[model samples]
Target: MIERGEDWVPPLPTGERVAGAKRRSGEGAAPTHPAKRKAGATERARELRLDETKAEYRLWGELRGRHLNDYKFVRQVPLGPFFADFLCREKSLIVEIDGSQHAESLTDESRTTWLNSHGYSVLRFWNHEVLAERRAVLDTILAVLEGQIHSPSPGLRFAPATLSPVGRGGGASHG
Candidate 1:
């Protein structure tokens, strides 16, 4: 993911591109909380629209209300100061899917910093991972969750772990 100003944005996968209608460029200017609208109304709008779009619907089918492995997840979950794509409240976990533009590393870094600071474990998958090999992505997410369940929290932070770019993946050989 890349950070242009403040938001951490992930890359868009090659084949699956978000249409221009959905792209919100120059979004850095929008306040995280727009003072003009009441907070409840904004939240309700987000909630109501969750299932109104294809991407959200597909993701909801995979994750809503324990749809996967009976593992309960709340959609459009509000955590800390932001909304999570999928959250398991019991585990304090967040799952986010990044698009192609996030290929620039900075965006992911900022997102990690925020999530880590909030005592949440975030697992991110590239859009391609979700689109091309969803099973693999799911397996990785499950493994992370299982590990967290067994161990004491390490208070992990996503501070520049060495990564092999996607196509060159050597299985994320970490330091």
Candidate 2:
């Protein structure tokens, strides 16, 4: 064994506890807290909420506290293994804001597929779209929340959310 400082210890994985470390899946190996695996995601999600993007901060202003047609939305929610930007449990919907970094991103596709498979619809908007066309974005979100945009394609990376026939919904993209 190598000598080490008393203060040093191996970093533990999220949800891991010394009490439950030895449990196996045969007879009695289940964790004491079934939600242990989410502990990490939960912490990370909280951090994301605290460090929200400018676009997220703007859109959240409209979605928070039932400001949008009485729909209650939560931010930085953990679902399965991913954290969603915003989620409305009543409608089983998730809304994500992306920067140019997300254009044509396979990761977003896979995450959307996973969320869709788990009975949730996802809506994505570019950061530019959110900041430049606040009304239309909110309208698109409102339309979705009201079941008017059922089966929303949710704006592919290159596409934009639609509020009307005028623009992508009625605005131009900065990105």
Which candidate number has the best TM-score? 2
TM of each candidate vs. truth: 0.55, 0.67
Q: Root-mean-square deviation of each candidate, in angstroms?
A: 11.8, 15.6
Tell me the lDDT of model 1 at 145: 59
Predicted candidate 2 versus true structure: per-residue lDDT over 43-102, tens digit per residue? 677788889899999999999999998888999876555677888766666888998878
lDDT of candidate 1 over 26-145, digit per residue (tens): 122222321122235455547545444444456667776676766777765543334566776555667766565756644445445544444566766666667677677667667665
The count of backbone overlaps in candidate 1 is 10
How far in Å is the alpha carbon of 146 misplaced in model 2?
1.0
TM-score (C-alpha, index-matched) for candidate 2 = 0.67
Reference-based lDDT, each prediction = 0.49, 0.62
> Which residues of candidate 1, in runs, are more than 4 Å off?
1-56, 148-175
